[model samples]
Target: MRIGELAQRCGTTTRALRYYESLGLLTARRSANGQREYDESDLRLVAQIRSLTDIGFALEDTRPFVECLRTGHASGDACPASVAVYRRKLAELEEFIGRLTAARDRVRAQLDDAERRSRPCKR
Candidate 1:
């Protein structure tokens, strides 16, 4: 397929496809007519990148996953590098969750104290 078709199929923009090419995440293959061409494998690659980014992975962070796909892995997370990225992302999410939980607890405590103070006093 052509670039436009690939973008449509991936539900992405042609500009984003070009950006991916520029980032070396995708190879810009040209047909004999000098137009960009892509095969099913390219579609798979874009899908991999999209899925990763949708889950909060940075564009740069998706490189290892893309490379894994390019290396013929059945899944993008099938390589050591991709696994390392997963581990790092998991740790980051865990830390953020902990902070959020603590903040939530503090807010709950404040609300409880305020409510108690606002209650009418017993005789």
Candidate 2:
């Protein structure tokens, strides 16, 4: 398939596909006419890349997994280093959630206080 078709199938833009190629997360062959062509395997790779990226994996972080996948590794998690990377990512996500939760609670309390102050005084 062409770049546009691949992007449409993956629910992404052609620019994103080109970016993925630049990041080494995806690959395509140039046709004689100079257009990029992709195969079914590339589609699957794009899906995996999209999922990992959505979960906050940096392009560099995802590179090893993508290489492992391309080389027919049984599982990306089977590598000890990859496991450690995921653990670190999980820890970071937890810490971010905690901070966001605290900020949200503080904002909610401020909103409640403002609401109380805006009400008319009761007898």
Candidate 3:
């Protein structure tokens, strides 16, 4: 298939495919006429990239999985590299949630203080 077919099948855009190529995450070959062409494997690769990026993973972060798929694995996450990315994403999400939790606590305290201050003074 061509870039357009691949993009439509993968639920992504041609511009995104080109960007993935630029990032070296995706690849294509040139047809006899010099137009970019792809195959079924390329379709799977783009799907893996889409799945990862849909859940907040950076485009770069998806490279390992794409490489894994290229290596004949059944699934992109079948390799150690993809596992490592999952670990890293978990750590990042944990830290982000921790920061948000702390901010929530502080906001709650401020709201409590304001509410107490607004109450009428009863001797």
Candidate 4:
């Protein structure tokens, strides 16, 4: 398939596909006429890239995992360094979630207090 078809199938823009290719996360073949050609494997790779990115993994971080997958590694976690990277990412995510939860609780309390103040006082 071409870039347009791949973009439509992935529910993304052509520019995004190009960006992924540039990041070395996706691979494409050059046609005889110089247009890009993609295969089913490329589609699956794009889906993996999207999922990892949605989960807060940066492209740089994802590259090693993707390489491992492509090289038929038994498991990314088997590599000690990869495990360390994942652990770091998980810790960062936990801290971010904690901060966001605290902010949400503070906002909820403020909203509740505002609502109570807005109610008419009982005689």
Candidate 5:
């Protein structure tokens, strides 16, 4: 298919596809007319990229997954490089979760203390 068709099928814009190409994460073949062309494998690559980015992975981080697919892996995460990216992303998320949890606990404690101090004075 053409660039437009590939973008439409991938639920993205042609501009984004071009950006991916510029980043070396995606490549398109040139037709005899010099228009960009894509295949079903390109569709899978875009899907993998979209899925990862939707779940908080950076665009650059999706490179390994794309490369894995390009290398003929049945699943992008089948490669060690992709797995390493997954591990790093997971660790980053865990650290963020821990910090958020601590902030939440601190806020809860402050609210409780304020409520307790605002009560009416006893005789």
Candidate 6:
């Protein structure tokens, strides 16, 4: 397939595809005409990349999965490297959520305190 077909099938932009190529996440071979050419397997790789990035995974975090796919794994997460990335990401998200919850509680307490202070005293 060509770059355009791959992008359209993978629901990404040609620019993004080019960017992936630049990042070494995706690769292509030059045709006799010098146009970029990709295989059907590239589509699966793009889908994996999109899935990870959509859920807040960093581009670098996607490297393991892409490598797994390139090595003919049935799924990107099939490799130990990919699984390790998943674990790290999960831990990071849990820590982030904990901090967010604490911040929310602090903000709520401040709002309640302000409301109490603003109340008018009755005789």
- TM-score for all models, in order of appearance: 0.93, 0.73, 0.95, 0.69, 0.96, 0.98
Q: Which residue runs does candidate 4 get wrong by more than 4 Å?
A: 73-83, 101-123
Worst 10 residues of 6 by lDDT: 3-12
For model 4, state the Cα shift of residue 54 in Å: 1.8
- TM for candidate 2 is 0.73
lDDT of 4: 0.81
Candidate 1 residue lDDT tens string, 1-123? 999999999999999999999999999789999999999999989999999999999999999999999999989999999999999999999999999999999999999999999999999
* Minimal lDDT window, size 10, model 5: 19-28
- The digit string of per-residue lDDT tens for model 4 on 61-105 reads 777666665676655445655677788899998999999999999
Leading candidate by TM-score:
6
Candidate 3 TM-score, true structure as reference: 0.95
lDDT of each: 0.96, 0.85, 0.93, 0.81, 0.97, 0.96
lDDT for model 1: 0.96
Clashing pairs in 2: none
Clashes of 5: 0
TM-score of model 6 (CA atoms):
0.98
lDDT score, candidate 6: 0.96
Q: For candidate 5, give the lDDT.
A: 0.97
Question: Candidate 2 — which residues are off by over 4 angstroms?
Answer: 74-76, 101-123
lDDT (Cα, tens digit) per residue for candidate 2, span 1-123: 999999999999999999999877888999999999999888777877788889889877776666766777666555666777788889999999999999999999999999999999999
Tens-place lDDT per residue, model 3, 1-123, is 999998898888899999999999877899999989999999889889888889999988999999899999999999999999999999999999999999999999999999999999999
